[model samples]
Each structure stands twice: as C-alpha cells, then as structure tokens.
Target: MDNHDLKEDPRLPYRATSRMEVVDVPTIAFLAATGEGDPNTSPLYADVVEALYASSYGVRAVAIEELGRKHTVAPLEGRWWADDLRVFSARDKDAWHWQMMIAQPPWVTVDVVTAGIERARSRRDLAEGGRVTFTTVTEGLAVQTLHVGPYDAEGPTIARMHDEFMPQHGYRPRGAHHEIYLSDARRTAPERLRTILRQPVEQSEPQS
Candidate 1:
C-alpha cells in the first residue's frame, strides 16, 4: 500500500453540535444520591434523571423536557408530593445499571426525594438489598442548559439561566430542580467538564 493509503483519516460518523435546545417532555424518573450531601439522613434528593432505556452497560438519555402533574408522596412526613415523569429500570447480567431520564416535573422538590428514600429504608423489600433506593419524579416541560465546564461550576450556570436568562425569556421553573453529568468527573477537568443543567420552566401565565 502507498503511504497515502497508510494514512487513515480520523473522523467520527456522528457530529456533535454546540448549541442548546429548549423542549417539553413527559417522563418517568428515578433519583439517586451522589454522596455530595448528607447520606442516609440528609433531606436532599440530588440526582434525578428520566428512566427511559436500559441495557447491560447503561441507557442513552437526554435532559428532561418537561415536568408534569403532581401526586402525594406516601411514606413521607408532612404530606410530600411527587411529579409524574416517565421512568424505566434495567438490571445488567452483572447487575451493572444505567438510566436515561427526562426532567422532573415542576412540583417535584428536593425535600420529597430524600424523604422518599428514608421511607423506602423502612420497607423490607427495598432495604437489606443491593443498592436499594427511593425515587420521586414527574412529567412536565423544562428548559435545559448544556454547560461545558466543571460540574462544581454548574450551579453558577444554572443560576444564570434561572436567575437571569429564563426570566428574561419570560419563562420560569416549573419542575424539580435537577441536573445530569455527561462527562466522567474522574478524568475530566473543571474547565472542560461537560454537564447538562436541566430545570423545568413555564411561562408566568398561560400563553395565548
């Protein structure tokens, strides 16, 4: 083979675009703790995603599009509520798991998530097992921000969108406050981290 033939072009079939899109979606969701806040006792439900697809490795996912209606969260104190988002579950042959999720409904709250988990802890089936957890989610419309920075910095980006951008655009959060990390933090950098900050938003009033 000639030298030209020996040169293999490096290109991927799929190209990623650098842009953010707004969307509304209905989904079932799941919540997991990242050990960032208090564990087993903290009233914080931090991680949430739409449980869409599942496989041995994991599932493909996008930020939630919308947060839906509300329902009472049983097994929790003070009459908690949960949103109606779409969710799916899968268990790998090796018991490895992956979850693809939509955004949380506007009604889903941080308090509800941890409260649900604590309640699940009392359940015989959910406890005394491998990775047992309690989840709270709902379906509704959401606005997502694709941030290309360290996960730690995601808060500021979300703050800007919620505190400034969305309001400027005449939209307000209407769902559970949530986010998703597309990049592996173990090997990524603070400046090069790829994270998706998704927040459910709605117009102040019904649009005409």
Candidate 2:
C-alpha cells in the first residue's frame, strides 16, 4: 500500500519560502483542541498536545491494520488569537487563545476518528481526550512564510506582514493567525526550528 503524506502533496500549500507568499487555501480537516494561556506554562496546552498525537497515531494504526493503508501523521499546527491583537506583539502569552491541531488525511472519517479515540483511551487515560474533535477549517485567501528561529522572534516578521506587506498589497487581515510546526521543538534547537506562519486575508476595497 502507498503511504499518504501531506508534506508531499502538491494540492496542499505545505511549502513556504522564507519570503512571504499569498495563496488560496481550501478546506482541510483537523483533529483540534482549543485552549487559552501560555503553552510553556499551561497544563491544558500539554494535555491537548498529548491527546492530539495519541489520537492521530491511533488512527494511523487502525488504517494500517484494518483498511490496508498507511499514512504519515502531519506535523502540529495552530490557530491563534486574542481579545486584543496588541497582546501578541507585546508577547502577552497568557492572553492568547489557540486551537492546536494535526491535519488528518482526506479519507479519515468520523467513525475512523471515533475508533482512534477509543484506541487511545484504551491504552492510556487522556484528560483532554473528550475535547479533541474533528473540524474543517477554510482559511480562503492567505499569506504565509517560513520562519526559521525561536518562536518568540516571529513577532517582527508578523509585524511586517500585517503592518506593511498586507496594506501595501491592498489586502486586509481577516482571520486568526495560523502556524505549522515543521520541526520538533523538543529535539530541535531553537535557532533551527522551522515554523510556517500564515494569515488569512481579503482584498481591500477601493477608496470611495
């Protein structure tokens, strides 16, 4: 059986150059959990991460054993926002609200996800297990870039994208900020971490 991998799929906008690029994003399914607070200090964040990966791997096992198919689990991704956008620029981690997720293959269905949850539950108790749910996100027109450094350093890059690039190009930010973690933070050095930062946008209307 052929292995399905999201990074290698041309239809998906998985590749991003260091320079910002605008692209139209289609609807994509994800196993997601939403929470608030700093990921480094929040217990909820840790629990959600554990639950997401457990469920994802469980689903992969089921696919291989029962359906005769295999797939590489996609990397972690996030949708971030807050009551005040300034909080992000100021690095106020406590005020952040985020949905942490992992992209699932197109063939994965509700039943498959449920079975995967069951499999994870059987192996170990996941406190946030119930919070993990299947969701589809349609970001539409978006601008993205590859950020290679510590997550904290992304502030300047994001500022440029939102305050300069978007406005200069006649685009307006429309949705929550997004990110794809291409490198495992636990094992990768902070300076070498690869994160894809994306923001949904819409064309600005002409002046009256």
Candidate 3:
C-alpha cells in the first residue's frame, strides 16, 4: 500500500506509530517481506527464498514505516502491510529487548521476489505482482501502537494507542509509525488478531 491509499483507509487507527524492537534478522530473504497476501496461494519461490535464508546476519534495531493494508476486508478480516520498508543496522546506547525474526538486509530492497519466484517454479510461473519494498532508514526515535482486535476493529485500538499508549508510555511520534503484524489475517481468527505497533521513543526530558 502507498502513502495516499494508506491514509484513506478506514481501518487505520492512528495517523501512524513507531516502536522499539530488535529485528533478529538472519539471511536476507527473497520476497524477504511480503504484504500482498495469500502466500500459499502464490507459487513458492523456493530456491531464491532459500538463498536469502542462508545469507542473513545478526539482529539490529532499525526504524520501520508501517502502514495498514486490507483487501476485501470484511467486518473482521482486515490485514496490515508495512510499506516503503527500509532498514539500517546501527548501535544504540540505550537498553531494551524484544523478539526478532529473519528479515531481508536493510539495504537490498529490490524486485527480486518475482524474479526468484519465477526461477523456482518447475512449470507454472505465477510471478510476483506485489512485494514489500525494502530500503535504507535513518536512525532516530519514533512512535508505535500495540493493537488487539479484529482487523475491522483496529481503529479503536489505534485510537487508544494515539491517545493513551504513546503519551503514558513516554513517546512522541518522530515520523511515520510502524506496525509489526504478528498474525495472518487470512488464517487467524477475528477475535484473536495479534499485532504489534512500534513507534520510535526516547527520554522526553533526559529520562530523569
């Protein structure tokens, strides 16, 4: 989803949010990250995906610009996709910890998913029509949200985040907020939509 489309979406709870996370990325992944939908519905680009899995490195805390994405969203079945995906591994003096997942290296966002997926198929080439774009992200503080609900109900949670979570948690949005969608809307139940909204944050007044 692009910026304008994202803003017009009704599911979006807030303008945007950021977070604190240690993306424990392994080898870069072909289609390293995808939000287009129906992963199983699409052809598996095994070879390229495998290679990306084999060549990733240590984890790092990089800012992510997350946006909500929903296709044919019903009352309960909406999904979010982080667009304009960017990454930049760096060092930080602060201390925080969280789970990490294998991700494409921050600098190599390209149209490799279609190319790799095409190369993997034996007979059918479905082709990669939608791929999460990855690129370089500058370091800084940001804001985010921790949403819990059906994809359709995320708006209220986003409101909670924008109003209560950020302010009480000592955060102010520095840029476009990010969302770490931990659940698959296609598979997960509507009542059990699990998502992590990550926003950049720092000591508002020197952490006194």
Candidate number with greatest lDDT:
2
Across 140-202, the per-residue lDDT of candidate 1 in tens digits comes to: 666665678754444456556666777777887674544455555557777886555566677
Residue 11 deviation, candidate 3, in Å?
30
* Error in Å for residue 64 of model 3: 27
Please identify model 2 stretches exceeding 4 Å from their true place.
none
Q: What's the true lDDT of residue 135 in model 2?
A: 91
The residue pairs found clashing in candidate 2 are none
lDDT of each: 0.37, 0.92, 0.36
Provide the TM-score for each candidate, comma-separated. 0.44, 0.97, 0.39
Please write out the lDDT profile of model 2 over residues 74-109, one tens digit for every residue. Answer: 999999998877676677899999999999989888
TM-score of model 2 (CA atoms): 0.97
Better of 1 and 2 by lDDT: 2
Please rank every candidate by TM-score, starting with the best. Answer: 2, 1, 3
**Residue 12 accuracy (lDDT) in model 1:** 10
**Model 3: residues >4 Å from true position, as ranges?**
1-102, 105-134, 138-145, 201-208
State in Å the error of residue 55, model 3.
Answer: 16
In lDDT terms, how accurate is model 3?
Answer: 0.36
